[model samples]
Target: MSLPKSNLQKIIQVSCAIIVSEDRKILVTQRSASMSLPLKWEFPGGKIEKEESPEQTIVREIKEELNIEISMSNKLPSVTHHYENFSIILIPFICKIEHGEIKLSEHQAFRWLNPNKLLDLDWAEADIPVAQYYLQTLNK
Candidate 1:
């Protein structure tokens, strides 16, 4: 039997950053073991709050999750992926670290990897497309 509309999965919107360093490396974070997709690497950011724009969401998420400030540059293509239980739209922006050091609050670890090396890590399924896009567009 088909599920009720209320029981259907919802599409979540998340704002992520492709944080570029002075040397042009991209920042990726590993999910905490307690998190749903534990130990998988993904770009740093979080779900958008109500009334928040994608830009605002990314800035706030970076501050909250990484304790660093970032200057946003251009936006990349958004990725939408579906899992068995839910779907998510990943909104990614190109950004540079503006200030502060990396401090992990919710993540297990962080890495600054060459864009070409991004695929070497085990990534969250939703974030794979983002990494591939960055590699294809920016790493060329």
Candidate 2:
């Protein structure tokens, strides 16, 4: 019932991004003190589980982490980053808020910043490229 050995070796991790905006500012979240990269700000998202599509993962992650619902849209470019412990292929989506006030369940704080100002903050290493793309494409 299982796939071949070649397929077994591949490890695919999934996550999502909620590109929330009001007027021109976008929401960004800070990783919690208990997290590995604590205090560094990141787009709110979490690990995608089995039996869910990327779109479903995005919705679930946002709700779980931010206590808000999002309308999943088209895919954004996937970014890959390697850390000392593990690497992740982050599939970020361009999403809009559907409902609920954002309540931080797993972070220190959240900010609504102009996309250009995104670069000014101390970002988690993995989020840098995604931030750059967001600023370049969405800020203007």
Candidate 3:
């Protein structure tokens, strides 16, 4: 049987973000044409499946979307954003890719960028706040 309608509606979405740093630059992934917001940049992640915790979801999603294995530790402040089609409660986490290669499966492109250059690209609505907060914290 399928999930109950109200239960499904209450299902909160979670995502993992690895501000994978090298020389103080962070990694960003561009959503593919098939995604909800095509070409819009976001931290790499996907839906948190049933029976999985947010941390588990992040690890699984990173492997599925980026073809990389990540070790997530320490949760960042979560962000809640509403979209035209659906609302998402994104749990941002600080993670590091401990293994695997950079492979873009669901995204079209990827970039390593510093905070100063982050504003140059159009970010996904949900990710805009995260990027802004990241910059603010970096500047302090």
- lDDT of candidate 1 over 32-100, digit per residue (tens): 999978899999999999999999999999999999999998899999998778899999999999999
Shift in Å, residue 106, candidate 3: 0.7
Clashing pairs in 1: none
Q: Candidate 3 residues 1-140, lDDT tens each?
A: 99766545443587858566647787899988888889899988878898898888888888888888888656777888877657888888877778888898889999988769887888888888877777777678
lDDT of 2 by residue, 22-86 (tens): 57587889988899898999888877788887778878889988898888666778888877667
Question: Number of the top candidate by TM-score?
Answer: 1
**Model 3: residue 48 alpha-carbon error in angstroms:** 0.8
**Model 3 weakest 10-residue run by lDDT:** 3-12
Assess the local accuracy of residue 96 in candidate 1 as a C-alpha lDDT between 0 and 100: 98
The C-alpha lDDT values of all candidates are 0.93, 0.79, 0.80
Off by over 4 Å in 3: 1-12
The number of the candidate with the highest lDDT is 1
**TM-score of every prediction relative to native:** 0.93, 0.86, 0.85
